[model samples]
Target: MENSKMLSPEQLYEKKIHVIGRITILMGIGLSLLVPILLWIYYGVFPPMDNLLKGVFTVSSFMIPLSIAEILSFYPILGSGGIYMAYTTGNIANLKLPSAAIGMEVADVKPSTKEGEIISTIAMSGSVIMCELILVVGVFLLGPISVKLNSPMLKPAFQHILPALFGSIGAYYILKDWKLSVIPMIIGILFSAFNVPTSVAVPICVLCSIYAAKFLYKRGRISL
Candidate 1:
């Protein structure tokens, strides 16, 4: 792994430029979709809330600032992609965000080659999984507590935690090897459409996809 601190000024500048560019693009896209997305969510959650305009305004006021702060601050603290998920989930139950956390600790390792990048990616995947597992457990516990406490707001928002976590993983793998990665996701979705039990369908689809990818690679059908 390449040491981030050892990079020359030019390389550091280039990396910063890349990060900034991505941040800007994402912010733009996020803002563009913010209103309609919030409105859709508002209706989904409160179908009888007839005051659509008021609800839209109220939700936007909260979401926009939260989105901006998350984009600007989360990455620096939590590491790449960490803040986004954390912010979306509104912090896990018992696992507090570290005060001096620098995202994924492994991300600072420089990736100077394909092997390095793969290793770094794997390390990052592990860090994210660890954080997500903590969150899933937290939410599972919190769900019942919120119910007992009669906190209706907390229940609905917390329900998004799992999907957002898994969606991040799915997006990462799909981006890495769409042709190979998508087969499993496709099968998973199809099985899910048939009302298959999640416990059975999810693992089968994921394992099938993984082994199928391995088989294809071994036969030289696809190259990473």
Candidate 2:
């Protein structure tokens, strides 16, 4: 009790955030499994154990690597609360990442800082709410929306949406410190040219960027 009372505000906040984040993650897992479990029970449909294991192995082979890479790459930037919220709500790369990055940028807060964590969490929550609302509206207007989206005029734009979004975000940072960005950009381009898998490429890029940054900093070419 005395030690707990003596903890700093930051320590207390960290403890609280971890407890809440753990609970949220557990709930997310339960909810994800609940639907499949319910459907199986209701329909009395169950796959043979061998087939089920095969299917799981095939999917996990592709997904597990990517999942591990994404968690490692995004955790430092998103922090704990932001991570829990983003993963729980899904759409991390497209929505939550951009929202959190922009929020932190606008707030002039660096990642891993207290201010960054709060801003990131808030940005993630806002994105989740907006996503839910858009999904609800989309469900009601699915037919019209599908027709519009499928139109040739809009099809190209939809097809390239992810690239366009990331390009815009990348342009900002690349322009901000073109020197530090050069090595990573070249690495990414080469990896893409060779059709490297993203799961493998992401960690390679991260490591290359880190070494590049360190080398540049040692030479006084860029400030950390």
Candidate 3:
């Protein structure tokens, strides 16, 4: 009788843990889809090519350190926050604080208490402040020097650099689940080709991919 009672409690605990795990995975998936959509929309509207390239580089350069910080946050295991932070701060001329605040909204996880939300907000804000300062100084000191040197090559050089950097970050995950990855990438490309807004296209493509993957997995067509 005692063993039966203990078994019930153990099973209950396991059930609760499983639920929590599912919730976390779902939250990570949601943020992974949502944040990119928001960034794409913002870029589409603002269209800052010079700052965009710089921001991409800055984000790429700090990916390792920011990823560590994100891991410590006990949020999603993916280092998207760091990448988002880098992209936002690198591009916007003077809106880092507001951008970070918006980022926190997009990155918020369920079951995150008020305190946790505040902490995420503050952390992102601090990152923006520091990154903005560095970007300003670099542009001021370096921009003129490059122009004076007639380095027309620098623009294209950095343009190629940003795409390569972002592509590398994306490749990290793509290689993990290549079979599942292709579905979303193809959908996203097709959606983008239609000139659909990034905010809508991203989530739509993600949902489509997720449902398709589940369908294929259940049918034994894919390992997942």
Best by TM-score: 2
Worst 10 residues of 3 by lDDT: 74-83
In model 3, the runs with Cα more than 4 Å from the true position are 1-144, 148-150, 216-224
Ordered by TM-score, highest first, the candidates read 2, 3, 1
Give the C-alpha miss distance for residue 222 in model 2, angstroms.
Answer: 2.2
Query: Per-residue lDDT of 1-224 in model 2, one digit per residue for the tens?
Result: 78779999989888888899899999989999998899899998788999999999988876888788788878877998888888888988878988898899889998878899899889888989999999999899997768777888887788888889888878877887899899998999999999998768887887888889999999999974
lDDT of 1 by residue, 143-220 (tens): 667656567766786788788876765565467567787677678778878987554564566458658988999999
Whole-model lDDT values for every prediction: 0.56, 0.87, 0.56
Per model, state how many residue pairs clash: 3, 0, 0
Put down candidate 3 lDDT per residue, 136-208, tens digits, no spaces.
9998898668765556756676667666865765575567567777888888778878887554665566567
Which candidate tops lDDT? 2
Pick the winner on TM-score between candidates 1 and 2.
2
